[model samples]
Target: MRRDAWWVPQIGAFVVLSSFLAYATWAAFQNAHYEFGSYLSPFYSPLITGDSPHAWFRTRPWFVPAISPALLILPFPAGFRFTCYYYRGTYYKAFWADPPGCAVGEPRNSYLGEKSFPLILQNVHRYFMYAAVLFLGILALDAYRGYWFAGPDGVKHFGIGVGSLVLTINVCLLSGYTLGCHSLRHLVGGYLDRLSGRPLRRKAYDCVSCLNRGHMNWAWFSLFWVAFSDIYVRMCSMGIWHDVRIL
Candidate 1:
């Protein structure tokens, strides 16, 4: 194990990142003013101030209007399992890498270094990558629903609430983060060896290569921001903070 006194920064990063993630997870479980039913019809608006029977609550059940808990926690383990630095022996050197702390006398076998289950979770990153991307589409749908016309004033409006902005920003951050992934970039654009002489191949490869260079930073930053987005909405719902509406 490479021993250096640089563990402070690693530990600090882990603590700050984990704290934000935990808060976001907590917020995701809280109920916000989500208009799941109104989204079914673009012309639906509950704040119309008339007895139009189009009130949103009639169609929307009060069940959890957010994602399943399993999907919420998926990012934590999935992120830890596939972190490029961890498998490459960075964890042992930086105590902060392993939140559980390093195990003494841990054998660093190149093949099965950390054994079965945890290692198996590493493969899940590929699958979760698809899931994360799909969630972006959902966010986009939510953003579209955020737009509405004020019935009382008969004025055109495209107002955004806390939840809608959160959803939109979450998707944007995730897209940037996902596109900057090293493994994903390789999977999508690294097949250039098979098309070496193709005119557009080299250009594609160059683009992915540039993204790959900043992949690590983007991955972590995006992971944190998405969680923060959910927290922002949750806080707004809890009356802890106001979710600013943008027109």
Candidate 2:
């Protein structure tokens, strides 16, 4: 009775997620071409230690292994997404076929839900939400910095470029996703029983709820844009694509 190609969405999720994972892994291993002028890849934002002008530290320790700076930062966002409530159900259905489609039968008899090992690990999502919020601030700064470029005399001045807009849009999308996190919603207002008593908490919770309603949309769009942001910076750095300054 319910045979209307319900598996299409699951298959789409599998392919997009799998392909993004592969591309992100490959891009993270390439240490170079992650920066061009003032444009920095979201994957390598808050540049810890490197030769780039954006690096927080001037030098890398000789004892440290040669690895992409992205590895140091990617874990936080990756963890947040991996433990995401939406993603958990997505992969469970799409990849594991726990219930391939609506009205479909489960492969196993017992349903442990998040009570099981790997799924239980998602309990840490609240902690990752904290990290994700902090990252929003950092990425917002990166976007602001994107609007300023070095002048010919080696001085920085206000300017706008394709990269700047790219970074800005990425930050907006990321904010939508990170702010809408279920854990954050609970932290902000879930603890209280009466929102009418606390105006501040009520407002905060309302804002978060607005975005939470579209969590799945925010997640997918942000995922795609962040990857595209990295690609844009990398291409510009490699001279394969040009960063056209508008200001």
Candidate 3:
């Protein structure tokens, strides 16, 4: 009813996040040109089915030639985000208008916590964190591959390119978001009643706690950077732009 500063950010987040979801969904189904030279789009990382010996899986249903390889793997990361604690608060307000913001009137008078059919699924966030960690490892490997390139002389050389740095930054930001997850923090040492006696676990808990303090910031940063990394690689693969060599 009343205009406020919070509404501006809510609307902005809704627009940006919706646009990204649309683009990512479209890009995932294309299943073409996800890799260019040393750069690989984050959206298509861990390429399951492709024309490479290193491919771990290949889809050959013959019924769907246009089926994208990423279609099979995107659900893991998508699930993690969909049920993320930070994201729950985000979309709950932005999209669902669950009391949109402080002092704002809610559309529903009766609030049903995540106990019903669909919302009860939110309880699976911890399990999704496990898969998210695995994906971080896979993406980190992709970033490492970005630093290696073959020369015209049929020799491999280690070098850095603009795409390499972009992918590296994307992985780092994602790692921050994943490692800082509340579930991870609880896993680290939340069960221990006396953390004072365990030095190693205490240190680990402190580290994760530090990151958790900035969880929201990491969430948005990683979200945008991953999308940017994918776009950068896509453009390079299409020959629309060239990756600048840094080394």
Best by lDDT: 2
Q: C-alpha displacement of 80 in model 2, angstroms?
A: 0.4
Residue 149 local lDDT, model 3 = 90
Per-candidate local distance difference test? 0.49, 0.91, 0.86
Q: TM-score of every model? A: 0.62, 0.96, 0.93
In terms of TM-score, which candidate is stronger, 2 or 3?
2
**Alpha-carbon RMSD of each model:** 7.4, 1.5, 2.4
Q: Looking at model 1, how many pairs of residues clash?
A: 0
Task: Give a tens-digit lDDT track for model 2, residues 101-174.
Answer: 77887778877778899678889999999999999999999999999999999999999999999999999999
In candidate 1, what are the lDDT values of residues 1-247, reduced to their tens digit? 5465445656765665567656545543432332232121111112222223334243335452434333444454346434543222434344423332344333343444346876555555556566555555555565566555355677646676555655566557666666555556666667445756665766666776786677656666665665565445445545777655565
Q: Model 3 misses residue 35 by how many Å? A: 0.3
Give one digit per residue, the lDDT tens place, for model 3 in 1-247: 5675878778987997898799889889887778888777888767766665335556554553456767877888888888999999888888999868878888888888787877999989999999999999999999998899989997779999999999999999999999999989999997778899899999999999999999999999999999899889888989998989989
Structure candidate 1, residue pairs in collision: none
lDDT-superior candidate, 1 or 2: 2
Identify the leading candidate in terms of TM-score: 2
User: Which window of ten consecutive residues has the lowest lDDT sum in model 2?
Assistant: 58-67
lDDT of 1: 0.49
